[model samples]
Every structure is written in structure tokens, then in C-alpha cells.
Target: MKPNGWIIYNGNLPGNKFLDYAEMIQESATKQGIDMKILKNNALLSLLATDQLGIVQLDKAELPDFVVFADKDIYLARQLELLGITVFNSSKAIEISDDKIASYQYMATHNIPMPKTIVAPKIFTTGNIDHKLVEKAIEQLGLPLIIKEAFGSFGEQVYLLHSLEEIITKIDAIQGKPYLFQQFIPSSYGKDLRLQVVGNQVVAAMERVNINDFRANVTSGGAMSVYTPTKEEAALAVAATKAINADFAGVDLLIGPDDKRLVCEINSNAHIRNLLDCTGINAADYIMEHILGVLS
Candidate 1:
């Protein structure tokens, strides 16, 4: 009998992007002779009581052998794991990959080459932030720094500030959310590389460029072209994926001064629709192959 699996994605998000992601995975699994289920994150309610943790699924369905978590709901992912089902990208990986500060911290300790970064000091209140802190950050990173919120996607919460006033204004808007300031990579301005990694290999790669914005996210109107990563880029992406303990990831890389690749961010449950459209390669195929390979 074929092994049964579930692909869970967030249902609260609008439109078909999430579903598209699940369907792609499902199609790949189907072709590989695995039985796959597509479940929305909201469908499984985490019912917790003292000394007991379980889920209340709609229609009281039987649990699958493995779960491919395509959502950021770490609690639900953890709950599924508690039920003895394997979650690809695991709860820990998803948690770490979803936060910028945690991702950078993990990579920094692991000797991953990246732009210099400083974690923002925690601010308890919406009150005034010390100007000195910003000054110190600027002194270390210099003018035109990058401000990125710990929790955000599609480059919506990333900012490039060229002046002190811009820094203050952005900080005031950020409130107390966890964020970090990073040195701007001039060589990577409006461009970066996205490498889709499965197991120990780079499955697909693309180069994204956006002239209108500093962030090179497709949602930010960045254009993507099929790219062939260098040996170093491939190794870095694989190492970063392993560092995060993710079964699969979309590793973003930036070009450094000498044309070397620097780790930008790792997406555990990365969106594959864009990668598919750009590369004519469905990362889902490689991901399913890797998952089944490991399980076997």
C-alpha cells in the first residue's frame, strides 16, 4: 500500500497561492505513487487539556503518516508532531525559518557568510527609543542600512533607510516588534538569488531583480530568470538548509563585493509557485523524491 501523507497550508490567507502550493506538492506526490491529502491549517483544531494534547479534526478523520507543513502556524505543526506524525520542515525548523532574527542568529553561529547584522534591542513600550542605539547601529553598518522585521514575508516589512530621520521614522512605526538592522549589500541591490534545496542538493535556482525597490521579492514586482548557481552557492544553500534542520528550503542569497554569495534568508515552507513559473522546474518533484527517499 502506498504511504499516506497530508499537505497542510494556512487557510486564513486570501486567494489561491497557498492552495496552489499544496496542489503542486500533491501532484508531485501522486506521480510518485504516494497517497496525499490537502488540509487547511484551520481544519485541525489543537485541543489541549492538562496531561493530554490532541486535535479535533473536522469529520474526525484518521491521521496521515506524514505531514508537509506549508503554514507558519508553529503551534499546530507542533501539535501534529505530538500526535506522532512526521512534519516536513518540522516545528523547530518552521519557527526558526519564520523569524529573521532567529534565522540570522542560527546562521551567524554556524559560520555562514552573510552581511553584518545587529539584533535590535528590545523595546518594552511604544515610548521613545534611545537615539544612541540607532547611532551605534549606523556606526557599525554605515549609511543606508537595512531594517527588517523578524516576522514578515514578501519583503513587505523590509526597509532601507538612508538617513537618521528615516531610521527614526521607521523605528517609531515598528513599535516593539522584534526586528534587526543589517548592513546594506551594494552589490546585491535590487537583486539576489533564490536556490530551492531538497535534501543535499540544489533542485532549482533563480535570480530576482527589481529596479523600483531595494527588496527583490516577486510580490514586490521583482523579475525572475532561471539561474545556474555556482558550486559555492550550492554548497552554501545546502549548508544553510542543514543548519536550520529543514528537509527542504528556499535559500535566498546575496552577491558580496567579490561576487561571492551571502546567506540572505531561508524559507522552510517556501512558496514554489514562483520557482515553478520561472524555472519550468517544479521543486515539488524534488521535494517529494527527497521525502520518500528519506522515509524509505
Candidate 2:
């Protein structure tokens, strides 16, 4: 007996984790006596509007049984929703998780502990980057601040400024783009925990440590290690995920001074390799199970 649904992936076919997970899901479904097909977004786009609905494509004319978004492609996900397809994490969840400042506000509103931070406007039109704005944030949140580009992945455009001089230099470089000025949580020591959440449950976790650099992203030469999170840590991770309405998410937490924990960032399309390697859990399998359950 063949199953009736397909697993839609949001990335290219080869050399990408998204594709890797797609293959894993297909294999898992095969074991469960379910028929599964892996399709890319581009391929899915071509078959849209037809009865033979393609599972993978950028433009989905008809609703699929389930769709997995790789990054924060909210517009496409919403389009599929309009077609009556059940998206794993709705477009609205992705939007909130993608925006760093918005996530912080959401967490704070929910009484979740988070680092004190400020969001600078997207456009700085005064021809003068307000030093006071940064200074005030520092005054309230304290020094060793982190200035981050609002929408970046794999630690590409994050700047860690240890001194006021560095902050000025980095702010000047990013003249007119929205960014965040957040107080650095020193306890992380260039390391943080990336916890996986599914259906608002914290399923797996890993500690990413960067010994040579300040950024703890695996792509940026960080080492991953397994760490058993405390009860408080796990609770916070789950709460943060729920607050953002993320069906599947990578939640980053920084251990702050006084042995406290602060929810730093939430990633919509979290990397599966690092967490799989660290925790020895097949994240792909977990995701597929959740998707299958939803469709069933």
C-alpha cells in the first residue's frame, strides 16, 4: 500500500541540509509503508494550478497535505495556506520568529526572561547615527553589546563589540539598516545552546561553542557538544517556542550573569546537522513523524 502524500522541501536538491532531511523523511515514510516524494520549491511551482499537485515548488497553486519551509518565506507559505494546504509552521509564525526584535518583545510580554535590547529603525535619515540611542541602550543593558542585522542566518552579519569604539565603528558601517543593540550575555563565553522545538515541545538540544571567535555558529568554526539542559532551561526553551507560535524552531539561549538564562534568538529553519551530531537524535525523523501525524 502506498501513502497518498508528499514531503515538500524548500531548498535545492543537492549538498543542502534541507534536501538531506527530505531524503531522510522519504526513507522513514517508506519504512512506515507510506509513499513519499521529495520535490523542490521550483519544481512544485511548475505543477501549481493542476489537479496533479506538485509537492515541492515556490508557487503552490493548490494546497499540499503539508509543506516545510526552509527559511522565512512567509509570503509563499501564506499563498499555500490560501490554497488550503496545512503548513507546518504557518507564515505568521515564521514572520515573528524571523524578526529578532519582535521575538524579544513577544517573549517579554509573555514574562519570558530575555536580554535587555533595543531595536533601531530600518532607516537612519538624520545623517547622524544617534550615539545616544546606543548609549542609552548600553546604560540600561550595559556594555559588551551585540549589534545584529535583523535578517541574517549562519552568523553572517552579526557584530560583537567589546568596547564603545567598536560599537561606533560597526554602527557607522551599517548606516541605514535596521539592527539590534542587545546586551551581551557573558556567561555564554561565545557558546550557546540551540534547542529544537516541535509542536511547542523542546525535543532536542546542543551546546555550540566557539573557542577562537565570538560567534558560536557551526559554520563559523564552532564546536558542538551535547549538554543536558536544566529543567529551567528546557522550560524556557519550550515557552519561547510557544510564544513565537513555532511548530518547529531552533531556540538559542545564552546563560547570563548570576547563572540566569536569557532567550536570545529563535530560528525558523534551524540546521539539523549540528543538533543531530550533538544529540544523536534523528531530527529529520522527528520532523517527519510530526508532519505525518498532522496529515493523518
Best prediction by lDDT? 1
TM-score, cand. 2 vs. native = 0.85
Give the Å shift of residue 63 in candidate 2: 5.1
Tens digit per residue, CA lDDT, model 1, 1-296: 66799999998999999999999999999999898999998888999998878989885678898989999999999999999988998999999999999999999889999899999988865578889999999999999999999999888889999998999999998888988999999999999999999999999999999999888999999999999999989999999999889999999999889888899999998999999889999999999998888777
Worst 10 residues of 1 by lDDT: 121-130
Candidate 1, pairs of clashing residues? none
lDDT of 1 at 102: 96
Q: Go through the candidates in order and give each one's C-alpha lDDT.
A: 0.93, 0.75
Output the TM-score of candidate 1: 0.98
Model 2 Cα displacement at 67 (Å)?
1.3
Q: Can you tell me which runs of candidate 2 are displaced by over 4 Å?
A: 1-15, 44-63, 124-126
